[model samples]
Target: MKLEKELIFPKGFTVRKVIELVTANERFASKIYFQTKSHQCNGKSMLGLMSFMLMTTIGESYIISVEGEDAEKVIQFWNKFVREIHENTTLSYWEEEGAQTVQEAMCQSISFWNSSVRSVAQSYLKPGKKEI
Candidate 1:
């Protein structure tokens, strides 16, 4: 199967992202997908995709080749799957710091803020004995 058309993606979806997604997600790892293969598309099996080890560098592209009566349908499904992931936002690993360290954390944060303010003020100061 050879991809008759090109599938372009943005910089964020580079080879690193492919590897990260595949490794982190069991579903993706199990899917029959290939980054590179003799056919445009590889077998829709996770193991098959793992074997391809696609060079997902910037501007790298792959052809998805399929045949038979279901070729179009399979292509659509593949495209849709990729599209969904592309549009989704990655969840943040760190949310709020939480109240576990509120006391010491608050003090440290305040100190940091004070230091930042002092540093910024120093840049704008005239020859003076520091403005409080």
Candidate 2:
């Protein structure tokens, strides 16, 4: 599935809010499919979604690209819920905790690979030879 468009929620969007919205409407939640990250996939877990919130000072928008079997439904529910929340609730923006960037994650993976390769090289080489 692919997102027909990107949906940007206002600054106060949070995982808790998402859960609330989903829980409030059971039909929408039941349709979610677990897929790898993409325009169609949630790419985020329930815990992750619940943890995310907009930053207050900047009031940063949450960018969600909806793609999946139920993307349209989720988007429709979320859009309607956001409008309702804005009008009816006093929202508090919570900052999402820091998460490793793709680059940082890749570097960590490479570091592990390098170390493992060195270890294997050492096992095959003479004691005085370079590990690489």
Candidate 3:
């Protein structure tokens, strides 16, 4: 089976969120790839994802292709993951102190990657409903 979807990063989206996607890909047997206008890379590779991210900006759409026995499952996971990221970005931007703008929230999220406060930002990445 094979599935593909075009998805856009919501406001306040950061590289750390890409890490979440890469991590999730590890659970499936699917061979997943992410494509931007100028580049394409394996979804399971952090370096590839980072390189791909460089060619795009927030709100820009990209295509994700998944193929294998678990393609449907991988697609479902992405749908839920993207929805959660959007919802959490909205909530975190408004709810977190000192984050008066979406960009601030994004910067804060990047900073979270290094400190103990990472857990706080990571909470935003948690799936809202049941896991796929």
Candidate 4:
């Protein structure tokens, strides 16, 4: 099984959040990849993620692809995680930090999904196999 979703980095999102995401990915058996328009890397690899992050900016969108027995669950987890970040950032800036108005927060927040969830047939190779 394979599941994919495009996600935008929310406001106040940082490298620490990416590390948290990668850590969550490591907890599962599923293989995950994060892809920007110009690059893609294994979501489970710290080095790969760090390199990928360097090329991406806040508010940039990326696709996350998950494959293996837990693909659906992985996708679900990511959806919830992203939503939490989005909501928390919005609320924190508006209410807690008082750095921005609610309107400003809403406008500045990166849109989480530019596209809907896509289910596709397996196309990525397993470990030790070249991707076709």
lDDT of each: 0.46, 0.47, 0.73, 0.71
Tens-digit lDDT string for candidate 3 (9-84): 5554478887887898988999999887778999899998778866666677889899999998998888888787
RMSD of 2: 12.7
lDDT of 4 by residue, 56-110 (tens): 6657899999999999999999888878887766434343433224334433432
Candidate 1 global Cα RMSD: 14.0
Q: State, as a TM-score between 0 and 1, how close model 2 is to the true structure.
A: 0.42
Higher-scoring candidate on TM-score, 1 or 3: 3
90 in model 2: Cα distance from truth in Å?
3.1
RMSD of 3: 12.8
- Range of the 10 consecutive residues with the lowest summed lDDT in candidate 3: 123-132
Tens-place lDDT digits, model 1, residues 16-114: 555644454333322233443343324544444544434443234665555554556656766775677556635332212222233334445444567
TM-score preference between candidates 1 and 4, better one: 4
Compose the digit string of candidate 2's lDDT tens values, residues 2-26. 5544344444455567678546544
TM-score of each: 0.40, 0.42, 0.62, 0.60
Q: Candidate 3: list runs displaced more than 4 Å.
A: 90-132
Per TM-score, the best of the predicted structures is: 3
Sort all candidates by TM-score, best to worst: 3, 4, 2, 1
- Tell me the deviation in Å of residue 125 in model 4: 43
Winner on TM-score (1 vs 2): 2
Q: What's model 2's overall lDDT?
A: 0.47
